[model samples]
Target: MDAAALTLHDMTAADVDEVAAIESRVQSFPWTRKNFADGLAAGYRGWVVRRMGAMLGFALVMDAPDMAHLLVIGVRPDAQRQGVGERLLRRCIDHCRQAGLPALTLEVRPSNERAIAFYRRHGFAQVGLRRGYYPATQGREDAWIMTLALAADAA
Candidate 1:
């Protein structure tokens, strides 16, 4: 897909249902519709990606005192590996930089090697681990905490 063909817009209340639906389809442990609504209500920075008026993905970020936290970033299953995620992530990084944040942080399932590789390729690094950070079909799962520091001279 051509990256230039995509459009991104700030997330709003009207987009909660569709964003949650996409989240449910893409994530095993998806955020509920209420979760998306509440995040928007709380003034989290969120965005929706569309192509030719079709929803392709969404991302939500929370601001911390010193950094931004990526709460969710999901791409439609059909859009995976097609650069939608990369564009969305670049937007997140840009947003953080515009906010003067020093870094961006997120936690991913340790089992999600593909996501880990994606983050690494985008300059994120494994910073720590959180025990029992997520529920699993069998038991709780560990989370890999990853961070991307935005240095003045860094990309």
Candidate 2:
């Protein structure tokens, strides 16, 4: 897909429903509409990727003086592996860089090898572990805490 074909926009209240729907479709443990709304109400920064007026993916990040936390991100099931998610992630990194944040952090399920690999490809590294950080079918799942340092000269 042409990179220019995708457009990024700041997420708003009106986008919560659609974003939540996409989240539900793409995640086994999805965030509800209320979750997205509350995040927005709490002043979390959000970005949505669209192609020809169709929602493809979205990312929510919480900014801080030291670092930015990627609270959650999701892409439409049909849009996976088409560079839509990568575009959204780049937006997040750009936001952090523009804010002068030195790093970005996120937690991922240990079982999600695909996502782990994806983050690794994007310059993220495993930094720590959070035990039983997520609810799983059997009991709980450990989370891999990943960090991406934003170097002064990084692109």
Candidate 3:
């Protein structure tokens, strides 16, 4: 599918089941539907990408007084490599820019090379690491803390 033409909409409670389903399929550690509910309750900014009546991806970012945190982003397996993730990520960046935030940050499992590479391509830089940041199959794993500094005129 040409993701470029996909419509992006604000995520709602009715979309939680489908979003959680996609997260479970793509992530080793997926967010539960309750997590989505709590995020929405706490007023996080969330968006869904859909086209031809199909859900392609979803992203939720939390805005702080100074920065934006990319809490979660998930794209369905069939939608992988179709630019859905990029479109979702661009939304995060734009949110930070509009809020006058200096940067957008995220934590990614070091093992997720695909995601790390994708963020790097989108101008994220690794700034630090957090021990036991993510739940691993066996125990826990560290996460790379990445930040994308937003220039006022940045694309």
- In model 3, which residue pairs have backbone atoms overlapping below 3 Å? none
lDDT by residue (tens digit), candidate 1, 15-68 = 998899999998889999999999999999999999998899999999998999
Q: Residue by residue across 51-139, what tens digits does model 3's lDDT show?
A: 88789899999999989999999999888998899989988888888899999999999999999999999989999999998999999
Q: How many clashes in each structure?
A: 0, 0, 0
What residue pairs are clashing in model 2? none
Q: Which candidate would rank higher by lDDT, 2 or 3?
A: 2
Give each model's whole-structure lDDT. 0.93, 0.94, 0.92
The alpha-carbon lDDT assigned to residue 69 of candidate 3 equals 97
**Given candidate 3, what's the lDDT at residue 70?**
99
**Prediction 2 global C-alpha lDDT:** 0.94
- TM-scores, all candidates, are 0.97, 0.96, 0.95
lDDT of 2 at 17: 96
Off by over 4 Å in 2: 152-155
Q: Put down candidate 2 lDDT per residue, 35-136, tens digits, no spaces.
A: 999999999999999999999999999998899999999999888999998998999999988888989999999899999999999999999999999988
